[model samples]
Target: MTAATQPLLPEGFRELEPYVVDWALPTRQERYDMRLSKDMTELGVFYDAIAPRAEAAIAHLDTLDLDALPEPELRLLRLLFSMILVSYAVNVFEQPSIPDAGAAFFDTLVEPAV
Candidate 1:
């Protein structure tokens, strides 16, 4: 099957496929950049979609080997990671960015392998 015809997320996570294009980023910096680019409304939308399914998603992912997750599972994992980044904005900051911080950015030099 062609890339477009292939599934972007695991079977159980088909509902989240809509978000994959925007939120299922592979790296910390990419996710962080995404978080910074959106407003509270957008971030909240993503948070609400994933929060309820967090436990189930984790359970599903735990069944797989982390070092060798299939592409769809890896995308799901990335979506989970994006959810984590969005939580801070939706729950804590109540905004898309850190308050009182000016032009600060994360220079992520290291990230765990997926």
Candidate 2:
């Protein structure tokens, strides 16, 4: 099959495919930006969907070499990264942006190679 026709996520992760467009960001900044843009309800929906499958997803990713992940696996990794960001908002802050941290912006200058 052509790359264009390939699945967005690896097998067994098809359930998460629906979230790929919005949550599967490649960089920490992108995930952070997404977190900031969404509300608690939106973030909660994502959290609810992924949290249940996190252990299985991590196990699947662990079988692959991080530097050599194929397109679909890489996307799965990014989805996990996004879940991390959303978790903080859903569980801790209970809001999109940090509490009492108005107008203060923090940028993730560097992130580990995907």
Candidate 3:
């Protein structure tokens, strides 16, 4: 595919996009389970597989000038950040009594003014 039609995320990372469909306005569980889910080994595999892709993707991202990225690429970057941030949250916060609190906080900060 030409660059215009190519997937915005770095190759393997594109598969992770669906989980972040509403990253801008995700429910608590959506945010909380962004990594592994105890009942879904497939998701667990996906979570496990993403680390290398994330490292490569972030390396690619660092090479770009954010202000100059095409709109689609920028949106893809936002999704990439969401994945990284959710992983970080789980590590730092563990399972919280309020699963969605972080999602709500992020929606306020990141969601467009629509």
Candidate models: Cα lDDT each: 0.89, 0.90, 0.50
TM-score of each: 0.93, 0.93, 0.47
Q: Write the per-residue lDDT of candidate 2 for residues 1-114, one digit (tens) a residue.
A: 997778999999998999999998888998898898888888999999999999999999999999899989999999999999899899998888889987888777789876
Top lDDT prediction, candidate number: 2
lDDT of 3 by residue, 39-88 (tens): 23433343455555767666776777865875445655655555555555
RMSD of each: 1.3, 1.2, 6.2
Model 1 residue 94 distance off true place after TM-score fit, in angstroms: 0.8
The true-versus-predicted C-alpha distance at residue 85 of model 1, in Å, is 0.4
Worst 10 residues of 1 by lDDT: 105-114
Q: How many backbone clashes does candidate 3 have?
A: 1
Quote model 3's TM-score.
0.47
Candidate 1, residue 31: lDDT: 94
Q: Write the per-residue lDDT of candidate 1 for residues 1-114, one digit (tens) a residue.
A: 997799988887898898999988878889988998998889989999998988999999999999999989988888999999999999998988888889876688988876
